[model samples]
Target: MDATMENKMGLPPPYEPAAPNPAPPPSYFGDNPPPPPGFVAPPVAPRTTVITSATTRPGSTKLGPGPTGTTCATCNKSIVTRVEYVPNNRTHIVSAALCVLAGCCCGCIVPYCMRSCKTANHYCPQCKAFVGSHQPS
Candidate 1:
């Protein structure tokens, strides 16, 4: 190919280096500032009790024993009670299939009304670790 044709070939342009970014400004508190008169910093809580799980269920004071005193396999800390709503097992799927096949009758909706349709899964809210699951009887 001629020199003009060579230059017109599918070749990328030359690379160019970008300019470096500027450093951030220093903080207002360079090292440590003196505390105000009669002012004292609050004491820090221990790491063990730093995280706590709050129950989301209303009017339900009872908590499952799955997380009580059980050491977390992930965070290596004491497990706390946490309730999570999870889909039911094969029962829900079978019920749904039967409902569809039965022309979605009123009686077919009974499966959806049953309380055993869903289950509760206990997990750590801190690191989102899977602790265990509980199926209602």
Candidate 2:
């Protein structure tokens, strides 16, 4: 009449303790076990390389005649400078004196028109900032 009596014949044999988990497998290291399979070591980060470079300071590098290449300080942009020539004061004075000595008033303007008698002013083409000047020696 009871449920236990009715199911006794269909039940599996009663449980028996499992052999104390078999002595764990031997490890290559003295006592530490190897990492479990499927464990990928954390990706080793690539070693960072330190690179040093020589830099030119704006003040240290003087601009030259023509379209000179340089970095602009105002805008901090690398560019080829646009050069504009203007008559040097010293050259003008000397030219005028030499012309008067030669007794020719029109000749005083000749040196002012010459490229070699002018000073070269360098400007950043991108920002139009004055970079430097090259005064003829």
Candidate 3:
């Protein structure tokens, strides 16, 4: 017999009218309804907070020698950490902009020797310093 005709579940025929569903009571559940007996709300856990410290020398100036905590390599005195940057092209750009603005040469922008030599796995021809791996120009 076909599945539908078999009443495969041994249930009454599918076309048999289901018993009329009785109308549900107007409100099955409501706020502030009295608990039947032993119902109780679970306690809530407190929220947690996390924080991290993220700070470095401002504008990427390397911490180095001289009288004050911040010192200029050229003057051998503390000019200010705000402008002086490590001897790179960027430092030159910054000093050049400063020269244009203030009309003075603040200091020489040192060429990046460490990277050029380290990349070649040889001593720096100019500085004569041994270059190490992992050093970036």
Candidate 4:
């Protein structure tokens, strides 16, 4: 190159579109394809699982539990009247709540005899039981 051309602006040669580009046909790529004329979305899933406790349901096969106590797992207000256990996925959730002004009491007590679909970390080593919940206290 000549010295006059060397003293030109610092910009390099403008990029030229290369030949023999391997870009595929339009059928193989996109952000999203055009939907069919009459497309319909799929259904949503149920988040909470079924509760298999007997003390709350006795001979019932309901999904969620009854109630909670005053001394709830959240607050120590001693207001709980019954416990509520909701089976979510593979964990058995334990919730404590309170009855209204009826002065009745409620609490959740796991039978410790039966558990199902335990997570790997929550499974008991000695008894092979599933304690549910990932939080360690």
Cα-based lDDT for every prediction: 0.61, 0.79, 0.41, 0.36
Using lDDT as the yardstick, the better of models 2 and 4 is 2
| Model 1 agreement with the true structure over 1-137: per-residue lDDT tens digits | 66566568965554577668868777777688667799988999877657665433322323352444355566766657475665676557757677788876554666555545556666767778766666665
- Candidates in descending TM-score order: 2, 1, 4, 3
- The lowest-lDDT stretch of 10 consecutive residues in candidate 3 is 114-123
Question: What is the C-alpha lDDT profile of model 3 across 64-107, one tens digit per residue?
Answer: 32111333333334343321122445545655676677666543
Using TM-score as the yardstick, the better of models 1 and 4 is: 1
Clashing pairs in 3: 115-137
Candidate 4 local Cα displacement, residue 60, angstroms: 20
Q: Which candidate number maximizes lDDT?
A: 2
Candidate 4 lDDT tens digits, 1-137:
75557559664755678877788677744777878899987989969988784332211222122222212222223332332232443233432222233245343333122243222122223333322232222
lDDT of 2 at 39: 89
TM per candidate comes to: 0.35, 0.54, 0.18, 0.19
- TM-score (C-alpha) between model 1 and the true structure: 0.35
**Global CA lDDT computed for model 3:** 0.41
In candidate 3 the C-alpha lDDT for residue 113 amounts to 27
Model 2: per-residue Cα lDDT over 7-95, one tens digit each: 78676555788897778876668877788999888888799999985464455467676777788877878888898999878777979
Per model, state how many residue pairs clash: 0, 0, 1, 17
Q: How many backbone clashes does candidate 1 have?
A: 0
lDDT of the structure predicted as candidate 2 = 0.79
